[model samples]
Target: MDPNIQGGSYDNPSQAACAHGHYGVAKLLLERGADPFSQGGRFTNALQAALFSESEAIVKLLLEKGVDPNPGNTLQVVAYYGFEAIVTLLLDDGADLNIQDKTHRNALHEAAMQGSEAIVNLLLERGTDPNIQGGAFGSALQAATYHNREAIVKLLLEKGADPNFQDVQGGLFGNALQAAALRGSGSIVKLLLEKGVDPNVQGGRYGNAITAAACNNCWWDDGREVVTRLLLDYGAILSDAP
Candidate 1:
């Protein structure tokens, strides 16, 4: 047996410690020349794996050892899970709130996509861009609306998110109102309408808010009736002509 290959595999000791929640083992590994920031397959590191497991103690231990909390692979994991504590820890450790992944989505975008209101609020407070775009989802507002996160949508609106912000792909791609309408969140739709979002604005595939609602079937139930009434009250066209 090669002396260098004894005990545990040297390359993945940190990851093993993280998986087992053995902070002491992790510390020993770090002392014995383990790389705290080693990225293995899929860009996953010990810190990222610990965060994914929501192992707060292991995460803290890694951070204390100077592991970066906001590695790109880890950011998506934390954001996808709406891990508020980990997110705060990462931000406090100097993680860039505005750093985008390959899809150009920041933490705020991920929080919105998951409808994690607390995480979204925290990110916004930390200066995450509310309107950052990319991904198939569009903006944070659109993500919130798509997920039917009415409370988050309201919060984003209060934070000055553009109700009519166009999706980056163009042709009504990023409209929060369209997202709300598509999800059949009547309250959110009404709120968008009140905020002056055009009820008849044509989204790329859905055409208009009404059509967006109608196409979703579940959204076309009684919930959409209230939305339709609100749109009509605001002078949305009832005509079939685009």
Candidate 2:
């Protein structure tokens, strides 16, 4: 077998083997001196393929055989997809916990969006900054809040995620309160307000939570009113005098 010969237009033999979870075939390719570091399209290396599949076993094989785990997007992809076991293995193998993607999103931000509390905790234990802003949701806490991941949001807050964190990720609105209110997550809105997030705080697509409730036409009035009432209960004094 020609070690470098591509299986077809999309990938080489090793890449194809790894992509299909053909662990034995991949092992054979490696034994025959196939390049473990070969890149094709989105998957930059065979280790990426290994992690993309049933993982643990394949990833372990790649690591033992001396494949470069590389950097940049690898760890972030694994975290984004909620592969806890693989993430742990990669971390143990010295993958950077704070490695950012093209949008400057780290593993923590991905885990927060995915509601993968286990991975979030692992990243935090490794010193991942919860307030680090990037991607559509800005901070990891905002990501969790936007998705109504109440458990994850609370966990982040407990770990010092700023409830009043301003959005710098270019999201329509730049605060967790706006995100929660617009999405009709009344419980999440209450949680943020309880955490001392100012309901009257001005920012985002709508200037404040009151305006966010007024402008979000996606939800029915019943839902919008719930969020509006919650905000008013939190001392958000409204006026058109401005």
Q: 155-189 in candidate 2: lDDT tens per residue?
A: 99988899998875576668999888877789889
Cα lDDT tens digits for candidate 1, 1-242: 22123234334766766776777877777777777777663225788667645877778778888876667656656877978887888888888887778767677878888988898888888887677776666788887887888888889988878888888565234577766766768888888888888777866556677666666445346577676677678777868524
Point to the candidate with the largest lDDT: 2
Candidate 1 global CA lDDT score? 0.73
Candidate-wise lDDT, in order: 0.73, 0.80
Residue 129 Cα positional deviation in candidate 2, in Å, after optimal superposition? 1.0
| Ten contiguous residues with the weakest lDDT in model 2 | 214-223
* Candidate 2's TM-score: 0.91
Candidate that scores best on TM-score: 2
Number of backbone collisions per candidate, in order? Answer: 1, 2
Which pairs of residues clash in candidate 2, taking residues 3 or more apart in a chain or in different chains? 167-174, 173-204
Q: What's the distance in Å from true for residue 31, model 2?
A: 1.7
- Residue-pair clash count for candidate 1: 1
**Candidate 1 stretches greater than 4 Å from native:** 1-11, 41-43, 170-173, 216-222, 240-242
